[model samples]
Target: MEKKSMKGYIYLMPALIVILLFTAYPLIRAFLMSFYEDYNMISGEYSRIGLGNYKDLFGDKDFTKALRNTSIYVVFVVPCSIALSLLIAVLLNSNIKCQGLFQTIFFLPYVTSVIAIGLVWSWIFNSNYGLLNIILSWFGIDKVQWLNKPKYALPSLIIFSVWKSMAFDILIFLAGLQTIPKDLYNASRVDSTPRWRVFWKITVPGIAPMISYAFIMGFISAFKVYNEVFSLWGGKAGPANSAITVVYYIYDKFYNSHNYGLASAAAVILFLIILVLTIVQRMMGRKK
Candidate 1:
C-alpha cells in the first residue's frame, strides 16, 4: 500500500510542478506586488507604497463605477441564468416531440464562437436598421438604441449573456434531473400527487446541488466578464464606460494607462470578491 501510494504521488509530480510554476508563482508574485507602487514593467525596479494603491482605487470614481457595474451584472446574470436554464432543461427533459432538436437549438449558442456572437449581436443591436429594430418597425414601434445608450447597453449585453450561458447550465440541470430516482415520481403518481407539489417538493430539492453549483459558477463568470463587453461595443466599454467591468478596469489600468500597481490591486480585489462569494455559496448550500 505504501509503495502504491508513493507511485501515485510520483505520477502527480509533473502536473503539480507545472501548476506551481505557472499558477501558484504568478498569483503569489502578484499579491506581493500589489503592496508596492508602480513597479517598472520593463526593468525590475520597485518601491513599496504600502496601501496607497488600494486607497487610491477605492477613491477613484472610475474604479468605483467599474466595481458597481460588475456587481450589478453579477446580481442580474447569476440567478436569472440559472432560473431560465432550469426552465429550459425541464422543458427539454419532458416527453415533448422533437426534444433533441430543441436541445440542439439551445446548445448551439454555447458551442458557437463568442467573438462571432458578439459581432452578430452588435449588428442586431445597431441603432439604425438593425434586424431587431427592423422587426419592431413592422409593428410600428420605434427603434430603441440598444448598444449606444447607457440605459440599454449593459442590459443588451446581459440579455445576450443570459441566453448564451443558459445552454451549458441546461445541460447540467438535465444531468441532475436524470440522477433523481424515477421511483419517487412513480410513487407520486400512484398517490395522485399534484405535478406542482412533486416538482417543488421532490424535483427541486433533488436538484438543489446543481442549482447551487450553477449559481456559484455563474456569479464568478459574470464578475469577470470582459470579452463580451469588448466585442459587443467596438472595443470601447460603452457610451461612457457604463459597461466597464472590474476585469476591464484592470486591463485598462495596465494596458491603457500603464498603471500596473493599480491593476494588481484591482485583480486582488476581484480575487477576494470571488473567494468570498464562493464561500458564502458553499455555506448556504450546506445549510440547505
Candidate 2:
C-alpha cells in the first residue's frame, strides 16, 4: 500500500510542480504586488506598502467605469445566456428531425475562435450595408451605429456575449436533459399534461442542478470579460470606453500605462468579487 501511494505521488509530482510555479506563484506575487505602493517591475522597488493603489483605483474614473461596465455585463449576460440556452436545449432534446445537425450548428460557436466570430458579428452590426440594418430598414427603423457609438456599445457587447456564451450552456443543459429518465416524460405524456406545465414542473425541476451550475460558472466567466470587448472592438475597450471591463482595465494599467501596482490592485479586487459571488451562489444553491 505504501509503495502504491508513493508511485501515485510520483505520478502527480509534475502536475503539482507546474501548478505551484504557474498558478500559485503568480497569484501570491500579484497579491503581494497589489499592496506595494508605486511598484516597479524592472527595479523591484516601492516607495511604501499600504492601500494607496486600491485608493487610487477607486478614485480613478476609468476604473470605476470599468467596474460598472463589468457588473452590467455579468448581470445581463449570465441570465440571458442561461435562459436562451435552456430553451434551445429543451427543444433540441425533444424528438425532432435533424436533431444532430441542429446540435452541431448550435455548438459550432463554442469551438470557433472568438475573434473570427466577432468579426462576423461586426459586419452584421455595421451601421450601413449590414444585415441587421437591412432587416431593420424593411421595418422602417433607421440605421443604428452599434460599434461606433458609445451609447450602444454595451448593449451590442451584451448581445454578442449572450449569443456566444449560449453554446456551452446549451451543451451542459442537453447533457443534463439526457440524464433525466424517459419514464417521467412518458408518464406526463400519457396523462396529457400541458407542454408548458410539464416543462415547468417536470423538466425544470429535473435539471435544477444544471441550471445552478450554469449560473455559477456563468457569473464567474462573465465577471472576467475582456476577450469579447477586445475582439468586438478590434483590441479596443469600446467607443469612449463604454464596454470596458475590470480585466481590460487591468490590462491597460499593467501594459499600456505600466502602472503595475494599480493593475495588481484591480486584479485583486476582481478576484475578491468573483470569490464572494461564487460563495454566495453556492450558498443559495444549497438552500434551494
Task: Indicate which candidate wins on TM-score.
Answer: 2
Q: Give RMSD (Å) of candidate 1 vs. truth.
A: 2.1
Instruction: Count clashing pairs, candidate 1.
Output: 0
- Ten-residue stretch with the least lDDT total in model 1: 1-10
Model 2 lowest lDDT segment of ten: 1-10
Candidate lDDT scores, in order, read 0.88, 0.92
Each prediction's TM-score against the native? 0.92, 0.95
The sequence of per-residue lDDT tens digits that candidate 1 reaches over residues 1-288 is 344456776889999999999999989977877888868888957787599889989999999999998888888888888888888887777678998888788889888888888999989888796898999899999989999889998898888798788988998898999898988988999999998898899889989889988888888888899989998987899988888899999999989998888899999999999999899887987886
lDDT of 2 by residue, 152-211 (tens): 999999999898899999999999999999999999999999999989998998999899
